[model samples]
Target: MKSIKSAGVIGAGVIGSGWIARLILNGIDVCVFDPSKDAPKSVEKVINNAERAYKNLLRSPLPKKGVLSFLDTVSEVAKSSEIIIEAVPERLSAKQSVYKEIELNASNELIITSSTSGILPSDLQSEMKNPERLTVAHPFNPVYLLPLVEVVGGSKTSQKVIDETCSIFSNIGMFPLYIKKEIPAFIADRLLESVWREALWLVNDDIATTEEIDDAIRYGFGLRWAQMGLFETYRLAGGEAGMRHFISQFGPCLEWPWTHLMDVPEFTEELVDKVSNQSDDQSGKHSIDELMQKRDDNLVDFLKVLKENRWGAGNTLKEFDDSLGNSRIDFSELDVSKPLKTFSTHIPKDWADYNGHMTEARYLDCFSEATTELMAIIGADEEYIANIGSYFTVETHIRHLDEVLIGEGIYSKTQVIYGENKKLHLFHWLHHNDGRLLATAEHMLIHVDLKTRGASMPGDSVIEKMERIYSAHKNLPKPEGLSRAVGDKV
Candidate 1:
């Protein structure tokens, strides 16, 4: 499938705004339109969300950011976008009217998709000028981070559209579940709705408070679900007997009165209040942003571990590996005169010293982080390291150039000092927001066997990577701070 160059998001509600953030952060140019006067504000909120998501993504490898535009009309966005996503409301008429406008102005080649929650694509496609191009691309909330998207195509939708949409979602780091036949609520949500019904019954009958019910799941099954889905977990539970055993043992519960599957609990104001209070109590003191950050932090760390094992959802590493196959280390060619990627980071409270300047240990840590980022660029990520059971980083020397205060913006730059088989020496400088070089660190790294924890010959693939960059920058002068070398010659 061809890469999506640009996308358009229609509507600025939570879902649409999330789509905007996700698209832009994935480096796809996005144009958004919503008639509401608050549309620009909504776009800004999305951009802000993207920025936060971008930071979270940095904990792993992610695509670069894309250009984002806020358009005044739906037609304007459609005119410029290769893929147009309609996130207008769940109302049938409102969505149909928006599709009408889209059909009038959109290019025939553009893919038009809806983010409708329950509305079937077949129903929406009935009025479309080109029903084959219309499909449902249902996504979870805060779409920038979550990795699941359900792609439901209508009766008239073409195979080409379905395949293309699947590829697009996969490229953007989301798992796409293609629905061969359009169904209400799609797959996951339908399963979730069943649980939701049971949950409501439990709460309505006072068998469990909302908080207690959530705890029962969050503290128990949620952990398993995070790593593997229900089927896999149940398969494990069955042990050597496998899924059939587990199912046979529990399948009889389906007929039990414990679940009021057909009952729809009344959405009364009192119930809402009770649920709200329970949710608030469950959340404790976390603000929305705080909760978002917590989720991001966990996802980042989780993905890092997945990347290590190359397990499920570790597809991000595979994507990274593919990119690194063509990965060019251009740092030597780039003027190390300036920071290549600059982002403000306040000195963490833990990094402070007795003199109130940043601690010596942290100075080394900051430069170490910069070097790790450089290694990431050159393909030293977890999977690569795990596969070979080898990693780089032999020695380091840090010199404090100037004092750094806690909570001040700290910047960093990596300069290539030397490169060879299984080894690359680098000099990294930590700078204050005021442009002062607070400290500099020089490091010598050797590829070592992770299993034995001993120095080893660099792998051929790693050596080739190093040779290419070293040959290119052969004549360049050594970086500062490397003039003073440490260690006894081996």
Candidate 2:
């Protein structure tokens, strides 16, 4: 499949704007078409919000953001795009008209997709000149952060279209789930609809409030479902017997009429009031904007934990991080005799504690990032650690010299104090942008073979590079606190 460098988005509502943000953040220029007068501002707002969340969510360096153009017509977007995603309302006539306009202007090779949550791809492609080029690429909300995108093809759609769409989505850090058979609502939404239906019934019957229902999920299976889907989770619940035992135990529930799956509760005023009042009582203190920020913060924290475990969505995030390419420093141009300026960043608001200064733990985090950058300089990057060997910090001594307020700029200068085949000793001085020394960390790292999980010597190239750095700094005067014990200075 041809690489996509540019994309087009129709309708600047929530989903469409999110797609625009995701594409732009991944370095794909976006051309957007929406009839709404506030389209440009709306899209910009979503992009800004997405950018904020990504700074906390992503640790790897990102490509330069892509350019965004607000166009007057769909034909203009179609003419310029390799892939066009139509995210207008779900009405058939409205979407068909969009396809007509795009088909009239776009090339036959241009891949066209619809963001309809449940509409059939076949129906959406009916009026198109080249229906085979169209498919359904449905994505979840907050599209910039969530990775799931359902790729479904119509009856007339070619396999090439599905494969290429999946490829493009994957390239942009999405986990594209291909639905073999084109079905309404695809997979996730159908499952979600069932739960939604049950929740409504529970509220309608006064058995549970909306808040209670949400709590039931969020505090329980919601956690499990994030990492493991229903079947696997149930399989474990079945104990040693696996899926068969699970099916036997839970199969009878299907016919028990325990859930109102076949019917939706009436949307009467009373029902609406009950649901709304309950929801408000549960979380009405926060405004929509505040809630959104909280949601993003919580997601980042949860994803970070999953990242450490390398499970589920975390694996997808890790893959995306690896694809971002290394940010290794080119040491050949630097004066290795002086401390290498390896890391620099501004403190974020979330890093502050009740005292308004950066939290104590964040000091170690800053030092750790500096150490990682130093490793990158010595030829130990993500790929190197994955394929060859890697250095693991076995010990660290940190002396806090000062406090840093939120939004203050800071940097770390590192020196290689000692080096050997399997051992590396380093020191990092953390300083505010104004040259005030804030902290210092001395780290001892040991090379280890990831496969064997045992100590191992690094490659000859790495050893040579370390030696060069160590030689350059050997004659330099050591800092005062270099080997001081943790207790009193005496």
Candidate 3:
């Protein structure tokens, strides 16, 4: 619930637009200033990409988006915003001038953050009148999905500014790694620079093509790096003895010239042509937008799998998801006497086929979520399940009546058929936003012991809640497709 009142973004290129999208999506109004004619288009594109990924990634309700306004000048943007983000070009003079303008129009209370990739925060803040409020909150490309942000404070910056920046970033679902000592290219980029330098050498020397180098990372160490990271990964690789033993085994290899560490390669036109052509050959078929879509889809699936296991980035997403759920409408507000409005969402692009129609499996996915929400209504939340037990779906019957397209808003209202003893039978009616019945799902679930994996008696408290709902629903007419088997007429 803690968030800033408003934010301002300067230079709506890739990074600036990304900040705008992330800020606005988290419900902070934004004033933007970008002199480029294409700034508006670029901002909307990033927002579109963010929205598409969010729909597939988070299961909870999203906060209402904040208002976005484009101001005529950088001074106007700074004057209107509580926080100012400078994401202009990397030139020192360009950044200093922007900071100077921001300081002139804004109060000393307004915090200023830079999205610089390699510039030191000290240099970034040196030109500002109130440099104490300056810090570097550098983020990776595709900022919405990737959670890591480097929060670096300059020598003149206040501890308050740094702390507040971290809090603001964390609220917007970012893991702000505080850099205690100001350094050029913070942390992640320093590591990335090493890899990039080596990759360039490999390409320049004809050791590997762009595709080959990409394949090695994507198919090999990249997978390990995503979950465990370097030192921890190597520690595991050390067999039973761990890090010390690993060093004993592989320390000698450091002396060998396996990489082109700091031996800088000449960036001749020939080298540039080679790298560019190779990259083109590798991914030339797909447009920039297509490449972005693929990257987002892959990341969403990875994060979803990690979430199920409660590991790595999954934990961060789970925390954000819980926060969203906490901010949502309470389940008790619903009338237990009627079919409950259990689940609702616009179908994400990832859920659709090439034709843009939602696939068959996603139908079951929607129903599963509806069933989960119903369980939550009847005292089967995570805490309850951990202490006691919960219901498990044993059977399902789904009738896909009408086709639904990607981006189409849909919802399900679930009715309790039988909510007593070990059995919990339910029926869900899925409807499009236009009032057409898109589908219906009938499910039967069993309450079970987590320890034994066998059927168990329902807890008295849960049974009491279920009994009340069942009593209220018992008088309703039976659903049309209830108990119907496949190939049987409804």
Candidate 4:
């Protein structure tokens, strides 16, 4: 996939700011134009949240941060960018004006995209001189974290543009779902609209409060939906009999009045007040900032869990991780002559102790993460564990060299002290961003067959790579605390 190095964003509201955040984090420079005075703060807020969530959710090192600029006009943003993202207000006239400016200022090579939630791309491209370059790249809110993007093309949109958009998005750690048939609201939003209609009716009729409806989802089917979509999950209900049999038994329910989805309740002022009051009652205590933090934290944790299990959205995250491995320094392909800097991330607030410095357990976590990456570098990944064998840490020594304050960035450099047959020895130095040594850990690992759980020889691939690393690292002075135990001086 050809990477998009520079992008232009036309607005900086919730969706526009999200696009800017996602783009810049992937190391793409962005120029944005939004007339509102709050645009800068909005983008900054989203970027901060995105950085926090990404540092927490992803273990791999991120690419170098990109440059961001705020421009006075759409023409300025369009002329400077390889791709133009129109995230203006959803109104047709507002969007059309932006497109006209883009056509006048941008080169024909530019790829122009819209972030409209439901507006058809055909309508958006109708007044464009380069309609073929224009497509709807609808993304969900908090776009930095969510991977799904719906790439829909209008009648004049070339397949080349659609393919290019998907490739660019995928390269930047997004799943660009090429929506073949353009329709109102696209796919996922349509599904959401059904539930939304039903929920609104439920609230209007006083059958359920806003909080209760949310509870029904988050507590019940929401978990299932995360890993398996609606149909696949329902397919499980069929059991050994299969979906056909399950449908035979329960499909008739669709004919029944189980849903108010077919009709939307009157959107009256009273109904709005009812929902507003109930929603406020449910979560008015938390500021929007607080709610956004909670949302990002919860989503990141859930993604991490899913990543561990390699399911659903988690699978997408893992693939994205694979793509972004060593974004700052490619670990698998690094020079073995030096200590390998395999991991880097900020010390999130949750990792801190009461005194506001990084706590002890997280030290082990950071070391283990670096070790795991080293293991993968030598052919001991999850697939290897499932099929062949893996290295199990048998012993560890950690020295606290200095304090890592909350929000401080830290990184690790690894040394292979010994690698032969069944045993492997590792030394990791955790360094603060400013070059201070924060901590050090030495680990002893034994390769074990998964079936027997006994010490065993790893594959030649693993042994060979480890030997190479060990050979290169043997000449370097031993790590300061190479074999030091607890309470021992360095």
Candidate 5:
């Protein structure tokens, strides 16, 4: 899978933000555009989500970091991007209009994928100038964490487009399922719509409350669906007779009136109110955001279990770990110091070693985590690093000055020694829960080009931010570690 040098996202809605998170987490450089007044808010929400994803990935292993940027127009992003993901609203005319503008600005080689639901690729391509270049790549919500993406091609879509789309999805750690023929709602959504119709009918007839229906699925079928999909479930249902026998018995339901697809629900005031009241009762007192968070939490827990077993999409974790390997960095002594800012991280039980002290590796991990926070304070937060491709970790020299037992938190004081060009030198002093200096680690970081894997100059904006901090510390006493530089200070 080739790395996406630059990608463009054409919307900033929830799904758009989700696409942004997925691209950014996978080490791609993405530029996003949306015409709404709340575009910035949308980007911020995605960044927060990306941060949460980053934390989760680190809980297991470090994930590839991607750069993210926002543009004012579709044409602006299209002009420079290698790939374009159209996530504008689901309206055909809106998507077609955006496509026309993108075609005018983008290169012929740029692959364009849409996140449209139930929109046939053939119909969507009919509206485009170069129809062969576009395909529909629909992804589920919370796209950064989830692995499934349905890749569907149109009549005019070239084989090359399909192959390239598959490659791009894989690069971003997604499971791309290609549909050989176009079908409305594709595969998964069609099945979901069938079930949804039945659910509405059940509520309309008051046979079961909305929550009961949901419970039936979540506590029953949903559990099975998580590991084995529909066909496999039905195979088991056949009791060793297999799908043919299972179909023979269930096929008679085709003539039943139990399903309500033929008639649209009246959606009358009474029906709407009934469904609404039942939904509210089913959800209890949880707010919409609360429900979303709950769903995310559950998915995270489930994915972690899969990750531990290396099952299903969780196998992607092994790929992620393979990419991480046994990388380590060490930087022993450096120059002088500024007043140290106190930073603390609680030592989790997992960090405890067989000897009952914090594991040496975890000491390094916590110190690295501290470095991330320091980078954030120095203006190297998610968005900035996303754009500039410059991160601070170079080398660290960690000394186990004292033992840290379980249930204890360690604090660190970071003092900047000096910084020049694209490098920063900092000193760290680790302390125990009661505030005694435990160890010290010196860090020498050279800003890097994430795409090229080489040292590069820090962005001017980032350097300016760093200079301001340096100026503020000019009058403060130099840190103890910098005692040698006291007489020869710059």
Candidate 6:
């Protein structure tokens, strides 16, 4: 399969713009064609939001964003693209015309995909000349953060096309699940539709308000679903007996009239008004933009937790980070005798406290990031942490020297004070952009075998590098706060 380096998007609606953001963030040049007068503005808004989310979502350094181009015609976009994704409105005739245009303008080798939520792939490919290149690559909203994408092939679609499409999506940090058979709505949407239908019925019957329904999911099973799907979650409910036991225990509920899955309530004006009014009441204080920002922030925190645990969506993020390759700065040319400038970043609004300045604990976070950078420079990167060994902070001493307000840029310079086979002593000085020292940290770390959870010496090469850095800093004048105890001299 050819590597995908450039892509074309046929629409600049929500899904299309999201695809554009994901592709560009993954370093794929994109050309977009959408005739809507407001396409440029809307797509630009989505891109901005996506960039903000990415800063918090990704821990590893990101590649330079690919160039984005707006084109006047579908033929123009298709000519320059290796993959053409159609995210036009969900109409059979409209989508068929898009496929026809793409087929005429693009090469036979070009991969063509549709982001239709439920339309069958075979129906979509019916009007195309080379239908074998067409398939459904359905993705969820906020595509840049969510990893799931259902790749379903039509009857005429080739296995090679499916495999290559999966590879391309995976390259862009997505988890592509191949559907063995083409079905309307594929997998995720079908499940979502079922819940949505039930939710509507509950509201229609006045059994639950819209906010209550949302609370039911967001406060309960929704958390479990992030890491474990329905069946797996139920398996645990069986209390050690597992899936079969759980089914036997709750099997009778299937026959019970507990759910109205087969029937759906009509979308009457009264029901719509009731649901809308309740929804407005529940979230009237926040605009759509605010809600979107909040959602993205929560997702970032959730995914970070998952990444640390190496489970679910976090695993996908970890794999993506590994694929991004090393982006650490080359410290070889620096004068090791002085403090090595390792990390710098702007303080985000979320890091501020009630006083509108950076919170106390966030200082530690800044220092920790600097320590990670220092480790990466000394060869304790992702591979070393996974396979060989890693340094764990055993003790930390933080002294706050000055206050840093929100939006201020801060940097840290680290020096290796001591190093041995299994022990490392380090200090970091945090400073504001104005050259004022904000804080300082002293940390003691121990190298440990990840598998054994015991202290272990790192490889000889890493040790040698640490020794050199230690030697460089041995004679440098120590900072005033070094080795000071928290007590007044009598």
Maximum-TM-score candidate: 4
Runs in model 5 lying further than 4 Å from the true structure: 57-64, 248-257, 324-490
Task: Using lDDT, give the best candidate's number.
Answer: 4
Which portions of model 1 miss their true places by more than 4 Å? 60-64, 268-309, 317-395, 400-439, 444-478, 485-490
Q: Please say which candidate is ahead in TM-score: 1 or 6.
A: 6
Lowest summed-lDDT stretch of 10 residues in model 3?
325-334
Per-residue lDDT tens digits of candidate 3, residues 261-287? Answer: 878799999999999999999999999
Candidate 4: where is the Cα deviation over 4 Å? 326-338, 347-365, 368-396, 403-407, 415-426, 443-478, 483-490
Q: Write the per-residue lDDT of candidate 1 for residues 259-321, one digit (tens) a residue.
A: 677889899988888778878887968898788767765765676566667776666544643
Give the alpha carbon lDDT tens digit for every residue of 1-490 in model 2: 2358999999989999999999999899999999889988989888988888876676565677999999999999999999999999989999999999998999999999999999999898887789999999999988988899999999899999889999898888889999989788999999999999999899999899888899999999999998898988999999999999988998888888688899999999999999999999999999987987788778877777788899888888888776674544466876787988877766766788988798889999988998888888888877798899899999999999899886577888998888878989998999998999999999999999999999999988888888998998877889768976698473
lDDT for model 1 comes to 0.75
In model 5, which range of ten residues has the least summed lDDT? 327-336
Better of 5 and 6 by TM-score: 6
Name the candidate, 4 or 6, with the larger lDDT value: 4
* Count of backbone collisions within predicted model 4: 0
Q: In model 2, what are the clashing residue pairs, if there are any?
A: none
**Per-prediction TM-score, please?**
0.78, 0.81, 0.83, 0.86, 0.67, 0.79
The lDDT of each candidate is 0.75, 0.88, 0.89, 0.90, 0.75, 0.87
User: Rank by lDDT, descending?
Assistant: 4, 3, 2, 6, 5, 1
lDDT score of model 3?
0.89
Off by over 4 Å in 6: 1-4, 321-325, 328-341, 344-352, 359-365, 381-460, 463-490
User: In model 6, which residue pairs have backbone atoms overlapping below 3 Å?
Assistant: none
Query: Candidate 3 versus the native: TM-score?
Result: 0.83
